[model samples]
Target: MTNPEYWYNTRTGEVEKGRQSAWTDVMGPYPTQEAARNALKTAAQRNENFDAAEEAWEDEWDDS
Candidate 1:
């Protein structure tokens, strides 16, 4: 099993990802990508999408 990871958006404070037909960002930090996908949960929906654009980015930078 894969250790599920959650990403938070820094721009709109909404986590965004690709859904079936379009993108969505309703409830973030979803347990699984499939959950996020179903609700269309994505950072872009809140108009805060970007390349690795998330509060977690800082952590990634720190690790590097």
Candidate 2:
């Protein structure tokens, strides 16, 4: 199989192609290095979206 084109190293906050460390230290199969580097930001944005959606659902349920 082919190696990943990009990876985000959460431990060191670095983006690189190919393997750098074990799975425990990495987090990506992102299409580009820029995307890999922004992994945390992307995750935060998704988390915010999920939280907002949950809050909205709760509000709707409470209105019923």
Candidate 3:
């Protein structure tokens, strides 16, 4: 199968195809343009949830 054709340029918040910039400045191999466009928001949401979960876990440990 071929690789995904869409990417999210984290540095510029642009949805594009192939490599438009350095690998470190982008985040995707998203299969659809819309998914690439929402990459940063999605990442932020996931990070927030993860941090919340980590905080809860730490609180549980602290109460032990």
Candidate 4:
């Protein structure tokens, strides 16, 4: 059997066993409850990393 998925409810800051909240108010289908619980932290880190990468890419192609 496959492992159950967990989701982080952004609206309520709760870790749910499945898609218990609206899609727009949830973070993910994490493999574990702990991972789901840290969803906001993970998303923030990912956003920071993505912004850094995008900045580097833009700098590489800057003509001025």
Candidate 5:
């Protein structure tokens, strides 16, 4: 059988074994409890990385 995925409940800052909260208040299908627990941190880092990449891409096309 497949293992159950973990989810981070944003509303209560808890790590759940599976989907147990409203979709709007949860953050994942993370592979482990630790990952789910760090969901906000992970998301912030990813957002920063994506923003940096987007800025670089735009800079590459600027002629001025």
Candidate 6:
């Protein structure tokens, strides 16, 4: 029952979560949890690299 630490990357327009430091395979520390995720999101998006499911992208589609 927590905020789950989310980040919004302006560079890539991607949102990411920490999911816990251990499972995330991260170093000791970075900036704020939100900052860390934003950094990763920016990097991934810069390379056009995405790991989430295709269904997830459906929300971004415009039906209107």
- Against the reference, the lDDT scores of all candidates come to 0.48, 0.88, 0.88, 0.93, 0.95, 0.50
lDDT of 5 by residue, 1-64 (tens): 8999999998899999989888999999999999999999999999999999999989988945
For model 5, state the Cα shift of residue 54 in Å: 0.6
- Per-candidate TM-scores read 0.24, 0.83, 0.83, 0.89, 0.94, 0.24
Best by TM-score: 5
Which stretches of candidate 1 lie above 4 Å from their native place? Answer: 1-3, 7-26, 41-64
* Candidate ranking (lDDT, best to worst): 5, 4, 3, 2, 6, 1
lDDT of 1 by residue, 10-32 (tens): 43444444222222423555676
- Clashing residue pairs in candidate 3, if any? none
lDDT of 2 by residue, 1-64 (tens): 8646888998998997976778998887788888999999998999999999999999999999
lDDT digits (tens) for residues 5-45 of candidate 3: 78898888888887688899889888889989999888999
lDDT of 4: 0.93
Sort by TM-score, best first: 5, 4, 2, 3, 6, 1
Stretches of model 6 off by over 4 angstroms after superposition: 1-3, 19-64
> Which candidate ranks first by lDDT, i.e. highest?
5
Shift in Å, residue 36, candidate 2:
0.5
